[model samples]
Target: MKDHLSALVQKANLGDREALEQVLLKIKDLVYNLSLKMLLFPEDAKDATQEILIKVVTHLSTFNHKSQFKTWVYRIATNYLLNHKGKRSKEFAMPFKDYTDLIDLGHSNEVRYTKNEGELSLLEEEVKVSCTQGLLLCLNEIDRMVYILTDILGFNGVEGSEILGISSENYRQKLSRSRAKVRSFLNNKCGLVNPENPCRCTKKIDFLIDQKIVNPKDLRFAHFSDRSIDLVGRIDDLEKSVAIYRSTPNFPAPEELLEEIKTTLKIN
Candidate 1:
């Protein structure tokens, strides 16, 4: 696939319209999924994905063949995410205790429940997704990106370093710190990490439902067809164990949006 994409990049740089479109299509999901994880909002992710694709298209000619085309594209996307000014406040930096406190505050109101097992399961999934995403956000930008690329997205150290314009050793060091931090937090606060942990997704379902953070009717993270991270094999190692929660579903770009991007680029 990388070789094919590199060939497409060669054609795209020469202004072959079909090749340009194909190139954009090839990386659309990657840009969107990364933006979604970083931004933690669908609309923001969509807008960012569009903007990143436009940048990629406009700058296609500057791409040298020294690196893989996909790596170049990822460099563009990751740089944009790291430096792009966000309209939304960075409210995700609070400590785990603070996050739970905020949730408890949201649970002040009393609400009735008539949810079935399926509905309850959906809510639990949402909680897990939301909390894990939140944990990612708590890390500093570089650490967060390293964790996302190496642990969550399953990129190797070399690829991750290339994407971020860093050394492989540096990427590994950052990843190690990130893993330790995440594992520590999960071990202390998440029941999935340790049965002895006081926090349980099941226990949070009512609070989330009452706060309308996890609506059965409007399921956010659970609606995607992509496999959940928890289904991955559980390892005894803490870093590997925590990685199970970091994996996210691939979020594909809508066909309509892809077409719109092609149109904007005036690609056939």
Candidate 2:
């Protein structure tokens, strides 16, 4: 698979459009789901997913096979969503160890539940979506990525770390904290628990359990190797697809993306 991906990337570099298409097709679901998580709307997720493909088609020649294609694509998606959010979307970004590590956590106010007469009045369906997005907002960006990759996307810690640019150790810790926060917030909002102060996350354990439950690792890990370097290639492939599709608002020919792929080689 490494040799095949390497060759595919090389072909893409040489402007073999077919090779690029092959690569993009492989990760379409990943791109779309990631966009949905990032944008929190079906329309926006669809648009971003399509745009990510287009970007990959145009810029395949420039992708340098670094930082796991998935991570690279996510980074692009994250940046676009953060800096140029769509109409009606929130703009919640977080500062990081690397300012370049900016992530679209979405603004605090966007889609936040309306407490009408003291109760969140979203319809049954909207409630799930709203609560999910609200829960996502509470997490710091990296933690959010880890949560989505594992919880929503199913990636393992080793692979997830590559996508989010964090250590496995940190990923575990962040995931732990994020899950606790999300579960706590959900328990309160769902009327399962009170939100007055020091949270009681006890029932969450049983809830997670009754669900056939989890300590769900970041959900997107089917293809990742146990190692980080391998994860970089996966992310590199992923980034190419994302850059083309799931932008925040306006999908521009990005500048930061050029640097993301190049950095992977330095690590390799």
TM-scores of the candidates are: 0.85, 0.49
Give the top-scoring candidate (lDDT). Answer: 1
C-alpha RMSD in Å of predicted model 2 compared with the true structure: 15.2
What are the Cα lDDT values of the candidates? Answer: 0.74, 0.47
Off by over 4 Å in 1: 100-112, 225-240
lDDT of 2 by residue, 1-268 (tens): 6568668778767767567656665556666667667665445666666666556555556667765565666655555544444343344332322211211212132222333522222122222233335346555656666777776566788877776566899989988877776654444343222234232222232233233312223212112213221222244434321211111122222233323433422211
Off by over 4 Å in 2: 1-8, 50-59, 62-84, 91-126, 191-268
Query: Compared with the true structure, what per-residue lDDT tens digits does model 1 show for residues 157-247?
Result: 9889988988889999999999888887776666676677667666666677776656767766876734353554354453544555544
